[model samples]
Structure formats: structure tokens, C-alpha cells
Target: MTTLQGSAVFSACAQHRHRLDRWWSDEPRALVCAANPSRTDALRPDPTMCRLAALVRHRPGLGGFVLVNVEDRIATDPADLRRWLETADPAAVEVARRDNLARIRALAATAPLRIVAWGTLVPPGPHRDRVIAALSADGRHDLFAFGLTEAGVPVHPLARGPSRVPLGAPLVLWRAADEPS
Candidate 1:
């Protein structure tokens, strides 16, 4: 799995706010909102929205739809996404992912559909962006990578055990268009 840093995500959102805004209004859009909830350092969805707002404000085409649990194939399915969001007493893994969905849904109701990505993080899961890409390949959504950072991008190694991926680095997340599978 690729280790995409939060900083990279943040930078992309900032640099491409205009493109993202435009894409939201005109083209389909999606984001791998979270690689790891603990890694993001965002407890509430407000910061997430703030980051998304930066792009949504500029790109009106960036509809408010995020891909949750981007690291897992089954978790990202449209049906699975709905189940995760609606489930009660979910497992710890589901809880983390659901939290992201909860925040995203809340953001959607409060703000227009601007930012789109998966909000959930499940342990021993695939990389966030990779899962998103898989879903994209499955015709679940679309993406655009017009504005990306040049340095300090984090990369997920997809290792096992309790080792944490290093942070405070730059990372790159590639976006995709939801073409027919």
C-alpha cells in the first residue's frame, strides 16, 4: 500500500481548490479522505470539511461525496458503504470507518457536496488511495489529480504488525476517473 501523508492530501486540496471546485460542478470527483484515522490527527469532521472547503469553494463540480474505508475492497462497495454508515455497534474497525462516514454525511448536510472520499480506517486494511482506486475501477466514482505536491510525500508500505508509518512528510495521492469497468 502507498503511504500517502496527510500533508500531501492537505497540500493537494489547497493547491487545486480551483480545479477541485470546478471538477465538483462539472466532472465527477472523489477523494481517499483518510489513510488512517489516527494518522490524520483529525478527531472531528470540521477540519476535514475545512480542508475540503478549500477545494469545494473553488471547484463547484467537486460534489460532496467521499470514499470511506478506502483500504478495503468490500468496505468500499456502494452497498457496503451504506451498511457501514447505518450499522449500530459496529466492530472497532467498522467504527473507525463509520466515524468518517458520519462526519462526511454531517458535512454534506451542512455544506454542499464538495469533498468526496472514504472517511473510514480499518486495521490490517489496504492503503486508502489504493482501495479508492479499486472502487474507481469498479465504477464506484471518479477523480482528478491536477494539483499535487512535489516533495515530502508519504508512502504506505502495507506492512503487518504494529509498526506505524512515518509521518510529517510529503505524500502523493493519484486520482482516477470512474470509467466503465
Candidate 2:
């Protein structure tokens, strides 16, 4: 089996280091998802990633998963970071989103599942909407999402408890508003 370590998958993500942050494992049974990069320079997995790895281990047919974010740059203040990304150069954000989607597609092609865990922090916009849609569009891959927060947003891996709650069906988070409450 081709491992993510030292594989083209890693290379593909590394190439986008200038625009986005990325993380992965050599394991093939990975679940790719989104989050803002932590406020640090280390390339290693952070606490949130460690939590996600633990959560996935409890589920059947999942060994581990890799983590990626909508934005690659470290966000010292994630709340402000979201605002910055929302107002930043639209063209640049679109480019980064496209690159992120491409990387996710490549990883999901081999992974057992992909999770939409960017959470409410990522503002709803055309670019964010499209990325979420693309991640679930490929029927060949099985996509899942964590339980929603009190405000009905998908719970980020770090904010969620360690319990192995059932993963919900793949959802286009932006469209969730139309669904009856």
C-alpha cells in the first residue's frame, strides 16, 4: 500500500506550503478534514489532531485520519483569523481553496473517509461553500461529519469530547440552513 509519508500525496501538499497548512500520516485509512493551523511553526500534529486520531480509532473501518485546514497560515487568534480570511484578497483565498480541494480530493481518493470538520469558525461564503461541496461530491469516497454544536455547527475535533459519537452523513454545511429545524 502506498503510504502518505514520502509519497506524492505529501509532496502535493508540501508544494502549497506557501498558501495553506497541511498534515497527514503514512496510514492509508485516513480521514481528511479542515481546520485553521495552530499558532506555531512546527510541522507535527497538534493537540486537536491528536484528539481526532483518538476519536477515529473508536469507529469501525477507521484506523486513523489526517488533518488539513482551509487556511494554511497559523492563526494566532482564530476568530480574527477567520475575519481576515473572509476579507483578504478574494483571488488569493480562491486559489488556496482550490488547492486545498485538490489536495483533499487526492487524499480522499485513497482514504476510507473524509470529514467536514471546519466548524462554524469558517465563515459561510462561496469559496467555503464550494470546498465543502467538492469534498462530498465524489461518490467513490465515504464522507462523514461529527455531531453539531449547540449552534448547529459541526464540532471541531478539539472542541468535541473524546466519546465516539456516531458520525453523521456527509453534509453540505451551508445548505443545512434550509433543512427544517
Best by lDDT: 2
TM-score of each: 0.31, 0.63
Candidates' RMSD to native: 13.5, 6.3
| Candidate 1 runs further than 4 Å off | 1-32, 38-45, 67-130, 139-142, 151-181
Instruction: Please give the clash total of every predicted structure, in order.
Output: 33, 2
lDDT of 2: 0.54
Least accurate stretch of 10 residues (summed lDDT) in model 2? 1-10
Badly placed stretches (over 4 Å) of model 2 are 1-27, 39-45, 86-88, 138-142, 160-181
Candidates in order have lDDT scores of 0.33, 0.54
Tell me the lDDT of candidate 1.
0.33
